[model samples]
Structure formats: C-alpha cells, structure tokens
Target: MTDAERIARVQLARTKGVGPLTYSRFLETYGSGLAALEAFPERVRASGRGELKLYPADKVRREFDETDHIGARIILSGDEDYPELLGHLSPAPPVITVWGNTDLLKKPCVALVGARNASAAAMRIAHDMAHDLGNGGYTVVSGLARGVDTASHNGSLSTGTVAVIAGGIDNIYPAQNEKLRDQIKDTGLVVSESPFGHEPRANDFPRRNRLITGLSLGVVVIEAAQRSGSLISARTALEQGREVMAVPGSPLDNRTRGSNGLIRSGAILVENAEQVIEAIAPAAPSQASLFEMPDDDLDDETLEFSEEDRARIIQALSPTATTIADISLATGIPSRKCAILLVELELEGIAGSLPGGLVRRQN
Candidate 1:
C-alpha cells in the first residue's frame, strides 16, 4: 500500500459514522482505501442525508505526525505485519499503533485475564501459568489492567508477551504501571487501536477486551466476578471461535462465580499450563493459516440496489438484532448484496452491527 492509501484508511476509521465493520466493507467494495475515500461522498449524497462531513485530511496528517513523534508505528488492516488472528474478526480493527516488537504478533498467543481486585492466590496462579506458557513458546496476551493482568505480564516479559491497552500508544493508565508498560515496550509489545493521544473511557475497556481475545488462540480466566470484564473476554472468545478455559475456585468466593459459570456452560476446565496447552493443541493446527482476503481478488464492482430493495431490507430489520442470512432469506436478496446494503445502512446511522454478523435497526 502507498502512503496516500494508508492516510485514507486512517481518515475513514476516524469518520463520525463509519465504524470498523463499515470501513472493512468499504474496502471490499472499492478494492483500496483510496478508492473507498473517493466513493464515499457520492454514496452519502445518494442516501439523501443532505450533506456529508468526512474526516478531515489535515487531522489525519496531524495524527500521523504525533504517532511518529512518539516512535510508534501504525499498522493498517491489510498490512503484512498485522496479526493474523485479528484479521479474522467480523470487522477487524482498521488501524492499530504499536510501540514494540511487532514480530511477536506472528507467534502463537494465549490470553489470561481476570478480576482487577483479585485474591492473592489467583494472582500467583496467573503469573506462574503465564511463565509456563511463555516457556512453552506461546506469547501471552492480556489487557494491561490491574491485578491478574499485571501478574500475567510480569511473568512473561522475558520470553514473550503482548499488552493490548485501552488508551493510545502514548497513554498509560493506572499510573503506577508506567514502568511496567515501558518494560514491555522494550522487550515485548504494547498495542492500541485508539488514536494518538486518546484517553480510555469506561466503555473502551470492553472494546479493548475484544482485542485481547481476538489476538489469541484461547482465553484463560483465573478469577472473575459475576459481571466482570474477564467474563466479557471469555464470551468474546466464543464469538471469535477461540477456546475458553477457566480455573475452578471455591464456591464460597464471589470472585469465582463467573469462571465457574463458564465451566458449567461447556468451557474447558484447566488447573495448570499443561492442561491449558492440551486444551488448545487441537485448535493450533486449524489457526495456523495466515488471514486470506475473501476471493483473493478484490470485488471492485459497484453493486446497485433498487429503491424497492432498500425498502425491503429496511423493513426486515427490527429493534431486535438478526443475522445477515436471516435478513437475506426474508427479503429474497442474495447474501452478498444484503451485506453491502447493511453496510450502507450502518454508515448512514440507520443500523448497527454486532459481532458475528448480527445487525439491528438503530433507534
């Protein structure tokens, strides 16, 4: 990809209404970021949305400048160095800023996450398990939160680890972990999908968790409360077709409820690194293929839909989420055409997409 194409991808990602999924669909339809950027204005006009306000070129340039000043590199979705597992996301992140060893992204990875205010026993187990996994040649992946996340990073720093942060590549949260963050940057890798200087909001952490599970072969839960972020990661792992493993704890502790629930719901029960390794070994061979773009040949055809077809699709959507295939079956439209229509609806703020191809009408 050219420099101009890279800038266009960033601009589309930052645009007000274009989300990750929409941005990816745009790439499929237009063949390149530059082509997508050129076609966006007319699509908006045809939608009768009145005026179109795209992300400014000047702002994109400023973002590029700030990233360079911090010695970080921005990798786009189609870049050769982008993680293969992440590319399999229904709508992969279009741009990610990395501060260290990009090569670690190519290796096998496992995510370890749990409660922020975890028990001492749980933290120790996380650390030791991470160390064992690292020695076994798997790069440990986790969000750089507090308790369990911190322990996981500390143990795997020497072998290999990847810290996927919620904030920008330059922003460090929990202030005390600044030194640890720097240490990982030097020896491992620190990743973020947020912009140059963005601080994380409350909702951003769940978004960050998705990336954690997306970059791994499986997720291991040490101790998670009933409604904790670690549980959210396990759910996302299932959605992404990755393995989910949990360490059982005493029934008396509230911290173990979520993990225990996972085991009951068919998640793998693991006590040590060896068990975790055994659980994921069957999946390793299937996940070894690098991400291949659909069709190998980009479909640059500008598919057109009639006004009646648009009305049928919009009518098929309800407040409740439904899959793309269901919508196609109801509307008698082909699946590819249905997907493209949904993408346009999403860009116009008429619909919203969930993981695993679900779409819903936006209120």
Candidate 2:
C-alpha cells in the first residue's frame, strides 16, 4: 500500500458509523480506500441518508504520528504482514497497530481466554496449557486482562504470545498490567484495532474479543460465566468456523457454567493441552478454505436502493437481531438489496451489524 492509500484506509476505517462490515464492503465495491473515501459520501447521499460524518483526516494523521512516536506499526487489512487467521474474518480489522514480533501472527495460534477474576486452579491450568501449546508450535493469543489472561501470557512469553488489547495500542487497561504489557511488547506482540490514545469503554472488550478469536486457529475457555466476555469470544470463534474447546470444570462453580455449557452444546471438551491440540489440528487446513469470500458478479449499479426501499428495510429491523435473509424475506426485497440497504442504514446510524450476518436496529 502506498503512503496515501494507507492513510486513506485508516481514515476510512475511523469514519463514524462505518463499522468493520461496512468498511469491508466499501473497500470491495470501490476497489481501494482512496476510491472509497472519494465515492462514499455521494453514495450515502444517493441512498437518501442525508449526510455521512467522516472521520477527520487531521485526526487520522495525528494518530499515525503518535503511533510512530511510540515505535509501533499499523498493519492494514490487506497488508501482507496482517495475521493470516485474522484476515479470514469476514470484516477483518481494517487496521491493527502492533508492537513487537509481527511474525508471531503468521504462525498458527490457539487462544486461551477466561474470567478476569478466575480461580487459582483455573489460572494455573490456563498458564500450563498455554505453555504446552506454545512449546507445541502454536502462538498463544489472549486479551490482556488479569487472572487467566495474565497467566497465559506469562506462560507463552518465551515461546510466542500475542496480547490483543481493548483500547489503543498504547492505552493499557487494568493499569496494573502496564509492566506485563511492556514485557509482551518486547518479547511477543501487542495488538489493538482502536486508534491511538483511545480509552476502552465497557462495550469495546467484546469487539476486542472478536480479534482474539479471529486471530486463532481455535479458542479454549478455561473458566467463564454464562454471561461473560470469554463466552462471547467462544461464540465468535464458532461463528468464524474456528474450533471451540473448553476445560471441563466442576458444575457447582459459577465460573465454569459457560464452559461446561459449551461442552454440552458440542464444543470439544478437553482436559489438557494435548486434547486441545488434537482437536484443532485436523481443522487447521480445512478452515483456510472457508475464509475465501464468494464471487459476486452482480454490479453495484444494478443493486441501487431508493428512499422507500431504505425505509422498508429499516422497518424490518427491530431491537432484536435478525439475519439479512430474514429481513430480505420480510421486506419483499432481494437479499443483495437488503444487504446494500443495511450498509446505508448502518452508515446512517439506523442499524447495527454483528458477526454472522445479523443486523439489528440501532435505536
């Protein structure tokens, strides 16, 4: 990518209301980030979405300058050095800022994620499992939270580990983890999709978890409650078609509820690193084939939507999430048209897109 295109990509990615899914579709339709930026506003207006608020170019430049000052590198989605497994994500991160060992992202990876306030035994299990998996030739990936996450990073630090953070690449949460974050930055890798200096909000962690699971061949849960973020990661892994494994824990322990439930619902139940390794090995090569985007011969010009069509699509959406196909069926619109409408709706802040092609009303 040229300097101009790279900058344009980041600016496009930072644009308000342009989530990963929309950014990806824009890139696909427009051919390049520069092209997308040039054409997107007119397209938005043409769709009858009054006006789209783009992220300012000045802010994007400042972000890049700050990232350079901190000695980190920004890897765009189509960049060669971007993680192979992560690139498989449908709307993979448009930009990821990294500190240290970008090469680790190329190696096969297994993610170890669990409760931030985990039991001692669970943390120990996660640590040992990560060490064994690392020694067995897989880079360990995890959110840099406390308890289980900290243990996993400690165990894999020497072999290879990638810490995916919720905030900016330079913003360290759990302020206590700052030392550990620096340690990983020196020996392993620290990654973030957020712009420089962006502090994480409560909702950002789930988005961060997507990257954790997206970057791995599989995800293993050490301990997680039914509503925890770790379970969120496991589900995202399943949506991405990556293997999901959970360490069986005592049913009485509240922290184990989600993981045990996963085993009951068809996730692989594993006791140790060996079982985790065996389960994911067979799917490693096959999963690669699943990431390829399908060919779409339909022309964008032919898929145009008018204000009435956009209103109908929006009417089909509710606070509850529904698939694009279902929305298409309900609104008497073609699936492709529904999709295009959703992107416009998303850019207008009328709808939100989730993984697995689900869309929900934003309000």
Cα-based lDDT for every prediction: 0.85, 0.85
CA shift of 146, model 1, Å: 0.6
lDDT of 2 by residue, 1-363 (tens): 788898898988998768888887677666898988887777688656766677888888898899989889898988888787777676688899999988897788899999888999999999999999989988999999998999999999889799999899999898999999999999999999898999999888888999999888899999999999988899888989989999999999999999999999999999889998899988764244232233455776676667788788878999998877678779877766666667777877788877655679988
**Cα shift from native, residue 152, model 1 (Å):** 0.4
RMSD of each: 3.0, 3.1
Question: Which lDDT tens digits does candidate 1 get at residues 171-275?
Answer: 999788999999999999999989888899997888799989999989999999899999989988888889999999989999999999999999999988999
List of clashing residue pairs for candidate 1: none
Which consecutive 10 residues in model 2 have the weakest lDDT in total?
286-295
Candidate 2 stretches greater than 4 Å from native: 47-51, 286-341, 349-351, 357-363
Q: Per-candidate TM vs. native?
A: 0.91, 0.88
Task: Give the per-residue Cα lDDT of candidate 2 at 38.
Answer: 87
